[model samples]
Target: MPEHPWDQAGPRFRPPPGVTLYVPVVVAFLVQVPPTIGVGLWLRAEPRWLLLATALAAASALALLAARAFPGLTVAVVAAIVTADLFLPPEVGPPPIALAFAIVGAIVRGALIWALGSVGAAWLVVVVVGGVNGHPWHPLRIAAATLALALCFAIGAGIRRRVERAASHRAQLVERRRANDQAERARIARELHDVLAHSLSQIAVQSGVGLHLFDREPERAREALASIRRLSATGLDEVRGVLAILRGDDADSTTPTGISLTPQAQLAEIPALVAERTGHGLTVTLDDGLRGRMPRSGIQTAAYRIVQEALTNVVRHSEAAHAVVHLSCEDDVLVIAVDDDGVGSAGRPEGGGVRGMRERAALLGGTVDLTVGPLGGTRVLARLPWEEPA
Candidate 1:
């Protein structure tokens, strides 16, 4: 696909190329001498008339240099030169190259109407003066002049349309790239949250337990250390899988896509998660009353993450010992609610976990709300569509 030259600055006046300005000056001056000499010899005109004609032609060519800056001025100057050439003492021909250059500049710089109006006015003057100078009324000449003006207008209009279309295409490509970037960011965020949130929460709680039990119960302290080692290993594996995907590595030996080297947490693993929390002295309960079982992997994964983040918040922020997770289906919505008896409040400050929950819910056309729980602590309520968007 050919890119538009002016996409970076749409619909704006552009300076003419250096070649365009200088080449016209040379060409106009060279062409003007031949006509001036011919008219001088044919009419036995004086040397002053030739000098006047040459000066007007040179000035008109210089006018093209400033066409983009002042297109109307260029057109007006060219029109004045045409008028003077027709009505002067000697019959010097109009500076056709200079006038054409001015007209082209006006069109490219968005002053077509002004340029055409000036040309028409000059042409009218030429016709009237030509008749008074013993020139006959020639229909062919009139028709040819009209056709030339129309052709210039048509070519300018066509180029303008092409530029507009190219600008639109460039805008669409930018928007599409932006949207893809946002989507990719969201996907990576979800993966990191799912992989790290639960593992980190378990490690923090276990570290605290192991320190407290270091002298009193050496066996349980050892168990806590063991749990930390397991969680760390799992977290590392998940991180490696994510890195492989980001690096565009070849498919893993087990999976075709290489996107998930470790098994993802699903709704079925809520019981195991509750058991793990129980080991850390946090009484975690699960109540699953949803009529729909695992509608899709995305919804199930999202549900698990919401519950996991909520429980993690309970473990980290809420000073409560007991937490309850409730999952139910209402109409076409799947609701996941986590409540605790900790010192959490709806007015308390939130972190990335809360934001991640909200973003995940929003992507599914649902919502995540934080409010005061019945147990005098913070509650997380996430609602998502049972059937995912296509």
Candidate 2:
């Protein structure tokens, strides 16, 4: 099965360690203690009430240590502590600083319902009980508290949104890189197949010819051996060029053998390619109608590969005596047609060679068609979109 986008990005976000873990707890406890201590002494509260207030503050602050791990539970627990503290002497009660942290933590961690419900319920109980005790909070104070809690909620929600957006962007980058890697691998595979298949096929044919002529015609056998050597050298150069490109080296660089790494075959080289095939006993002809009009480099490269693969297929599969390759530009489209007088695709299957041909053409917004030719054999016709040289 295909992988999910998140899986590619890696595991889900986690709270950072070390200082972040303890800082909030320390800060909350510190803030909560001052009011509890100062107000309790100012009110001249009994020793037991002041001690209870201090313990309640400590409990609420310590509860926050678990807020990131269990946001909802921490919020509920802290809210209960704050509500109990509210029942103490009004001036001696500490502010709900720890509760604020719990609410924010809960929302940021996606426990919105728990945070909102607990805080709302606790605030309602305080209001109802204060009114019953004839010590109702002032309207402005209640409104300010409500607004502060809302601000905490807003802050948490904003942080959550930002974190989610960042994660989505990271996932997109990972997916794009993966797609590029797959495409590069496919391109390398096609290049390797084209180089190795054509070279091995030619070497096999030449070796067979040399064996057949070794006893009858030693001179012809020597020519076959020479052809094999030339083909091998060219194939090695092309392979090294591909490897150099894969290694992020300059395509125009040279190998240790002093062979210039030719990145791609151009249209001008097709004639030499045809001549090489003709020398291997496969009579091939080239009809160049482009004159001086050259297509863009991309189109030229794709066209050259299409033509090369087609001719390679003909040499390997076609039992013909002669083949013709015609090139022309019609309606701003580069047209390449290779016709052979072979067995007319009797048992030809759409193998990797044909697929590679189509892929090369498609990459240039072009199409390749295989059909019966007027030469009573197979015809590979490719049309690529092109712009004439200015």
Candidate 3:
């Protein structure tokens, strides 16, 4: 709905709905005037014939105006004038110039049946009157008239089709844009939930431990305070990284910019994640199969986030003391599974964290299956395609 410059240029440039900005009616009127004057002068006809010729020109001009409201009426008027001109003389030169414009208008405005019927009636009138007045019916003139009418209809139909196609293409583009916006929003939500949930849970646990032991054990309290400080700084830096990405800045650069920085989390970071949870009284073990290099960044990030969320859920909701994280490649697919000796029953419903893990895996062409683990606890298993589809 952007405004066009022509709309602001002047008031007289207004056009009706569905019509182009510039109307061709005035040009049609002007084109009709010269032909009428030319026809009368070329024949040197009597005053009565000149008057009739002038009236035909006036009717042609009126057809231009009438076409804007009733294109079928314009077609009928033009056809009648053409039939009357045929009775005057052989060299009277068909109908007025407005006949072409009127025929085109009728076809473009959904009046094709009316326009063709009018033309057929006019052709019959020409034949009957010519036979009665001793003028032989000319087949070549009739053929030419039919061809001209056909050409007018074809051109009008072509323009209408082109406009329809352009409008359809625009609608498709708008729908695509809306879909992309929704996908980007979902991606951001997943990123924020994964980053904040785990880090805040760790901070909360460490703070509670520090407060409990502040007077009973000073040294242990100092260590807990140190962990809290480190966790806070790490959480702040990760949040800053997300914010920089939102601002369209590159936060993935390994080169330090006044900050102790590491790369974005990937499959390589699962061991560190497990070690961190182990210090918090969760006995965790890790097993790796795909060792040397990883696949695409997206697949690696999704794998890492899935493990992170599963462990976070165990730390926050489960009463488990031991956990196992396994990563391996099977059938050209990266597989990640985490099992915890935590409560696994229908009483504990799945939360958004589980849904977020599923969404992340699905985005990377993967699936997550939740069930009871071998150790009589909850199990979170996921499989991701190693090679991304084209």
Name the top TM-score candidate.
Answer: 2
lDDT of 2 by residue, 1-390 (tens): 234555565766666775665888999989988778888888898888888888899899999999878999999999999989878864546578898889888988899999989999999998999999898988998898889989988988998898789888878978887887777777888888778877888898899999999999999999999989988997898799877777778766887678777656779989988887785557999999999788888788888888888888888888888899999999999999999999878666788888888987787778999999989999999999995233
Better of 1 and 3 by TM-score: 1
Compose the digit string of candidate 1's lDDT tens values, residues 51-152: 777677677777777776788878888878866775666643644677776777678778878887898888887788778878844888778777886776
Q: lDDT of each structure?
A: 0.77, 0.85, 0.77
Instruction: Report the lDDT of model 1 for residue 1.
Output: 22
lDDT score, candidate 1, position 334: 88
Residue 206, model 1: lDDT of 88
The full ranking of all candidates by TM-score, starting with the best, is 2, 1, 3
lDDT of 3 by residue, 1-390 (tens): 223343354433435654531255556556655676676778787778767766766676666677868889888988887677656542554345577777777777778887789988987787777788788667897787778877877887886687667668667766765677677777677777888888899888888888989999989889888998888777777777766676666654432335523326788888899999886677988988787668888788889989999998888888889999989999889988899898864477778778889988887789999989986788899999998766
Once fitted onto the true fold, the runs of candidate 3 whose alpha carbons sit more than 4 angstroms away are 1-23, 41-56, 62-97, 105-137, 207-226, 243-263, 279-283, 289-298, 316-322, 341-364, 375-378, 388-390
TM-score, prediction 2? 0.83
Residue pairs of candidate 2 with colliding backbone atoms: none
Name the regions of candidate 1 deviating beyond 4 angstroms: 1-46, 69-72, 89-95, 110-154, 248-263, 279-281
lDDT of 1: 0.77
Name the better of 2 and 3 by lDDT.
Answer: 2
